[model samples]
Target: MVMIDMRDIQLDEDESEDQYEKLLRRAKTEDLTEISGIGCLYQCGVDRLGRPVIVFIGKWFPATKINLEKALLYVIHLMDPIVNGDYVIVYFHTLTSNNNYPSFTWLREVYNILPYKYKKHLKHFYVVHPTFWTKMMTWWFTTFMAPAIKEKVHNFPGIEYLYPDIPPQQLEIPAYITEYDMTINGIRYFEPDQSQNLLS
Candidate 1:
């Protein structure tokens, strides 16, 4: 695993993501490929997908506010060919105690500032909501909420939903995925969204 730094992820809020990434790459060019992790740092204004190309992962879970505008700006910048395939790992900056979790307030606040195209990316999010649910909350929203959201997103134009649950081991996945995440692993293969009630 490469050792990426916190700065790599906290791109400038004013600079375009490409410029920021360009600077980052130029600065860490020799060691870019070697970095295995990074830490909390938020940037703003990105691609149409709102997916931040830069990811920050830390030993402790992320508990910091993820400047959703910044984060979504990143994601929007990453859509297109990137979203077509591959799953990027996300480590929500989890903090030590009581106050831990994405700052939804900040997220909502910054969300409006997103570029029209960036906002468009989230529009297709309905297709990936289940995975988003699994990734973000580590809980099966389908089981709790109506699978309607999942189905709705699946219907979005140009969106492809892959790995309904877990594909056979032979299938190639971008990252190592466990049937259930060890710490925050969801109840996969159990109480699937199809169950009558999530409690089952």
Candidate 2:
């Protein structure tokens, strides 16, 4: 019988821990002014379940103009604190043209590097106004690379559907998203009073 060396396995584990520590250090120190200025990602408050809500406005993300590494670091920085506990993500796919979408390779790389702990604590991932491409890509990625998160992903046609899971009062939904929802749904799911209050 072949015997495995315990020393080699211990060394590998140590290296992995060191790499994660280095990543955390970079995430803390990185200057991400430009990325933050884009208004792509932010903590919007807590959901009805009291889980922290992280919102991602896909239309605002300038995938082509920004450095992917810095963008990744910024995402890590934003998520680091909250990932320690239960959290939910609201990704607005409205008005996300081809230019705004990042490369699949970049996404895959980000997914591969993220620790299991980060994935474990994410209770839900709500995609608002997801396009066909968005659905297809999400399916492909979840099916092959990240099966663990597949069940957590939910798609809603408009903002109103999100209210049942995440309270409308908690989220600072952008005017553009509301307008688009109105344009497509042809009925005001969000009342005028609610719109004014959220926009204010």
Number of the top lDDT candidate: 2
Model 1 weakest 10-residue run by lDDT: 152-161
lDDT of 1 by residue, 39-137 (tens): 232222222233333223222223363333344333344333343433222222221233334554554443333323333322222221233333444
List runs of model 2 lying over 4 Å from the truth: 1-17, 188-200
Estimate the overall C-alpha local distance difference test score of candidate 2: 0.84
What are the TM-scores, per candidate, against the unseen true structure? 0.31, 0.86
Task: Please tell me which predicted candidate would have the highest TM-score against the true structure.
Answer: 2
Q: Which parts of model 1 are misplaced by more than 4 Å?
A: 1-36, 39-61, 65-100, 123-200
lDDT of 1 at 126: 23
Candidate 2, residue 86: the lDDT equals 88
